[model samples]
Each structure stands twice: as structure tokens, then as C-alpha cells.
Target chain A: MINKATEVFVSRGYDGTSMDTVARELGITKSAIYHHVKSKEELLHLAINRGISALDSAVEDERQRTGLTALERLRAAVHASVVILIEYHHSVTLLLRVRGNSDVEREALEQRRKIDDKIRALVAEAIGEGGLRSDFTPGLITRLLFGMVNSITEWYRPSYPVDPEAIADAVTSMAFNGLEA
Target chain B: MINKATEVFVSRGYDGTSMDTVARELGITKSAIYHHVKSKEELLHLAINRGISALDSAVEDERQRTGLTALERLRAAVHASVVILIEYHHSVTLLLRVRGNSDVEREALEQRRKIDDKIRALVAEAIGEGGLRSDFTPGLITRLLFGMVNSITEWYRPSYPVDPEAIADAVTSMAFNGLEA
Candidate 1:
């Protein structure tokens, strides 16, 4: 039920979604929803937490892997991120849509920043190790690489047959080699 | 007055904005706004078109610059895009928020695709000329490049001391080198 409500909230946006609409989608009373979560904000928070945990888990997994070069580890991290994002499309969509206006939204934003910092650290390590090319500033490279990765959320639909690994491969390759001949 | 309304619309979102609120901020009659535009949608259309025209004009200018390599032209296109996006931040904010629900939105989306095609062609030409790396798929690389370029819209503020040209140079360099050491 929370998942269904999350889809509605993602499509309608938080400000556009309402308790009554969530109830309508679930064919349950508003009181029934209240039984589970305190309010729509709570649902948004729950959904964001689920998505954040998936990303954090992916990063943690990559960190635990041994004997990999920095570039190899970064590739694994990208793969895991793409898979997790595709797997939890609805919840992650809500997470991406959030603007830090309310308390819950601000908390989610802070959590996201921490997660971003972890990912950025991984990229920074690779840069420091000379596994990637030099000349580009680390901060700019991090943002561009993540921006490329994050753009998957805008166009990817789970129903599409494109494998998550394939998407990650294409993204990783593009990040390394630009479109010049 | 329109600037005040744009600030509210950008911050609060289009659906969340109301004419009465705009009037309240300006201390004017709601009827006064109707004299300027027929409806909120008209105002939205106007705002988005302003940004769209700027992008369109930039692309045209780059296309017209003779004797430059495709790579050089692409660099100019990117620089102009960031500057124009910063100049019309509120309009671009609204433009990015569009979800493609209406006819105007659909048209805007088509125009966006057209701009994308123009950039992709330049990327393709650069690739063919051996100016860009060719290890990645052209389609994916084009999207990633644009993703990194367009993501600037999310964080750039005109009030920030950072020059858009500096950002453009950073993005162009980072897109080529990546974050690996």
C-alpha cells in the first residue's frame, strides 16, 4: 500500500498529491492510511529512506570488494547504483523529486548530501591514485560523472528491456571516452 | 510585477502558484494580472519561451560561426547555454519542471529534442574528425554530455560569484578527463 501511494506521490509530486488521492488509489479509507503512516510527509520520508538505503548499501558493497583498481571499483559502484536505482524506481523517483522545504524534506536532503559525499570520496580517491586522467578538476569531474549517472533516472523505465548492467556499461564507457572520433 | 510573480512561481512551482498570491505579493488586484495575460498557463508559456529562445539563439550563433572546428563550436554552444540559463534562471527553472502533460509542453519537448539533435550532430562530427574519443557509443555520450551541461540549471544562481564561463570550461574539461586518477 505504501508502495502504491509512493507511485501516486511521485507522479503527482508531493505538493500536488493528497491523502484522499492516496486513499482512492488504494481503495482504502483515509483512516486506514493514518493507521500506517502519520501523514503524506511521513510517506515521502519513508520512500526516500528506502531509496537512500539502497544506494548506501551499493556503495558499502563496492567498498568491501578487494584487489580492484580505483577505476574498477568505480565501475562496480556505477553498476550497483544503476541496478539499485532501476530496481526501486518509484521510491527513488520520490527521493529525486524532493525539494528541501519541509522538515522531512530537509532531513532527506541532508542524508542525500552525505551519500553524495561518500560517492564523491570514492571518485576523489580514484583521481588521487592517478587511475583516471589528470587535467580536469576533481570537483567538476565528480559533478559531471554523477550528473551523467543521475540522468538515467530521468529516462529509464523498468518496463524497458534494457539491462541495468548494459546501461551501466554504456554510461561508464561514455564517462571515460567522450563522443569525439 | 511579472518578475515578482516569476520568483513565486519558480520557488512554489506552477501548480502551487495562484494569481491571488501573485496579486497579494504585489498589492494589486487579481484583475490587473488578467490584463497582462489571459491565464496562468499563458504566463508559464511566456516564461519558458523566454529561456527557449535564448538557447535557440545560442545554437544558431554557434552554427553560423564559420572556420571553427565542431569541437570549438560545441564549446561555444555550451558556454552560451550556461550563460543564458543563468540569465533567465526562473524561466529555466519552470522549463525544467515541465512534465510534458499538455500540447504546449509537448511542443516544448519537441523543441528540446531539436536542440539535442543539433548538439548530437556536432558531437558526431567531432567524433568523425578524430577530435573526440570514440570508445563510447555516440548516442550515450551525447546524452551524458548534455546531462552534465544541463545539470548546471539545477545549482547556478546569478548572484553567485562563479562565472558561467569558468563553469563551462570546467565541464568541458571534466567531460573529457573524468574523475579517475
Candidate 2:
């Protein structure tokens, strides 16, 4: 049901979507939806949480927690983020489009910031150990790295032949080695 | 007036904004706004075009046009894009958030795609001249590069101490040299 709600929210703007629309799309009564979810806001919260939990788990994955080094863990996190984003494309798309008009959205934004802080910490650790460049601030590096990865949500289509692993590889290569020949 | 509208759109969202709100914010009569723009859609068009024109001018700047290798031009475009995005942060924020729900929005999206294609061509040319890595497709590279650059619209604030030149330098360095120590 939350998946269905996510699809509606992704296709229709969050403000434009309603419980009635979700119910109509699901071929269920509004009362049925209300029985499970109290409001459209609740549904949106659940939908966004799907993407957030995926990202949080990716950063806290066993590999990231016990990696070869900070750089390795950072790379793993980046790769995992791209993969998870692709895996939960619809929900993440909805999450990314959020503009914090409501308390639920504010909470989601806060959660996203926590994830960003974790990635930034990994970047700082990598720079500390001389695994990554230290000239740019870790905060800037984190934003750019995630910016590149997060862009997948804007243009990626399931119809495309590209897969998550391929994207992860490209992001890792371009971010670490750059485009210089 | 378009700038004011852009500000309102950036804060309240395009759909949530109305000419009445813009007029209220600007301390102008609705008739005065109607004298210039036919409707809210027209205002949105003008606002988005402001950002689009800046980007187009950056790509067509004399520096981008003459006496540079493909790599140099690509770097120049990257730098100019970041600068322009910061310079026109509000309008570009609205432009980036547009989902093409209206005719004006569709036109804006089409213009954005034209700029994207131009950048992609630069990436291809750079690869042809051995200035960039060819392992990743030009399309992928362009998306990632702009994704990183375009993200400025989401977080950049004029109150922040960061300057456009510094951002441009960081983007060029990280994009060309990458993060490897």
C-alpha cells in the first residue's frame, strides 16, 4: 500500500496527492486506507522512510563498519548509496523531491542530514589517513560526492540497460580517479 | 518582478505560489503584474528563462568560444555553470524543481535539455581529444558532472561565506584531478 502511495506521490506532486487519490488508484475504499494509515501525511512519511532506512542501512552496513580503511568504507558507502537509490528509485525520488512543507518532511530532512554527517565523517577520516585529497574541506567533498550519486534519481530509468553495479563502478571511478586520461 | 516571483516560488513552491501572493510580497497591484505578465504561468516562464539565459550566455561566452582545447572549454563551462547557478540561485532552484506539469514548465524543461546536450557535446569532444576518461559514456559523465554542479541550487546560500570562484576551482579540481591523494 505504501508502495502504491509512493508511486502516486512520485507521479503526482506530494501536495497534489491525497488519501482519496491513493485509495482510488488502489481500487480500495478510503476507509480501508484510513484503517492502515491515518492520513496522507502518514503515508508520505512511510514512503520517505523506506528510502531513508535504505540509505541509513547502507552507511551502517557491515562492510562500512569493518572496512579495510576509511577510504574503502567511503567508497563502499558511495557505491551502496547508488545501488540502494536505484533499488528504491520511486521512494527515493519522492524523498528527494521533498521541500519540507510539513512536520513529516522536516523529520525526513533531519534524517537525511544525519546520513550526510555520517558520510562527511567518513570523508574526514579518509583525508586524515591520506587516502583522499585534503585540500577541499570534508563537507564540500561529501556534498559533491553525494551530489553526483544522488543525481541518479533524476535521470535513471529502469528501461535503460545500465544497472546499479555499473553506475556504482562509474561513480567510484570518476570520483576517485577523475576523468584525466 | 520576476525575481520576486522566483523568490516566492523557491520558498513556497511553484504550485503554491500565485500572482496574488507575488503581488502581495512586492507591494504591487495585481493589475500591475497582469500588465507585464499574462498569468502566473507567464511569470514562471520569465523567471525560469532568466536562469536559462544566464546558462546559455555562459556556454556562449567568448572564452568558451575561442582559443581553448575541448578540455579547457569543458572546464570553463563547468566553472561558469557553477557561478551562474550561484548568481541566479533562486530562479535556478525553481527551474531545477520544475516537474513539467504545465506548458510553461515543459518549455523550460526543453530549454534545460538543450543546455544539457551542449554540455554533453563538450564532454564528447574532450574525450575525442583524450582530455577525459572514456571508460564512462559521455552521457553518464555529463549527468554526473552537472549533477554535482547543479546541486548548488539546493544548498548554497548567499549568507554562506563561500564564493563562486572558490566553488568553481573546487569543482574543476575535484572533477579533473579527483579525490585520490
- Per-candidate TM vs. native? 0.84, 0.94
DockQ of each: 0.45, 0.79
Candidate 1: stretches off by over 4 Å: A27-39, A64-72, A101-103, A132-138, A159-161, B1-4, B24-36, B68-72, B101-104, B124-139, B159-161
Per-residue CA lDDT of model 2 for A1-181, tens digit only, reads: 8888898889877887777788899899999988998888998999999989998998888235763899899888888899999989999998888778899999998999899989998899999999998888998888888888888888999886777899889888889888888
Docking class of 1: acceptable
Q: Write the per-residue lDDT of candidate 1 for residues A1-181, one digit (tens) a residue.
A: 8678778887777787789988998899999989999988888888778888888889778966899977678778877877788788778777877788799989888877876777677777777787876665555566667777777777777665557777777677656654434
Which runs of model 2 end up more than 4 angstroms from their true locations?
A62-64, B62-64
lDDT string, candidate 2, B7-106, tens digits: 9888877787777889998899999999997888888999998998998889867235777888889888889889899999998888898888899999
Per-residue lDDT value at B158 in model 1: 71
In candidate 1 the C-alpha lDDT for residue B112 amounts to 84
Best by TM-score: 2
Provide the lDDT at B134 for model 1.
66
Q: What is the C-alpha lDDT of each candidate?
A: 0.75, 0.87
Residue-wise C-alpha lDDT for candidate 1, range B1-181, written one tens digit per residue: 6666777788777777788887887788999989999988777777788888899889889967999988888777877777777777777777776878786777778888888888888878777777777655556667767777777766667765557777776676556544444
Measured by TM-score, how close is model 1 to the native structure? 0.84
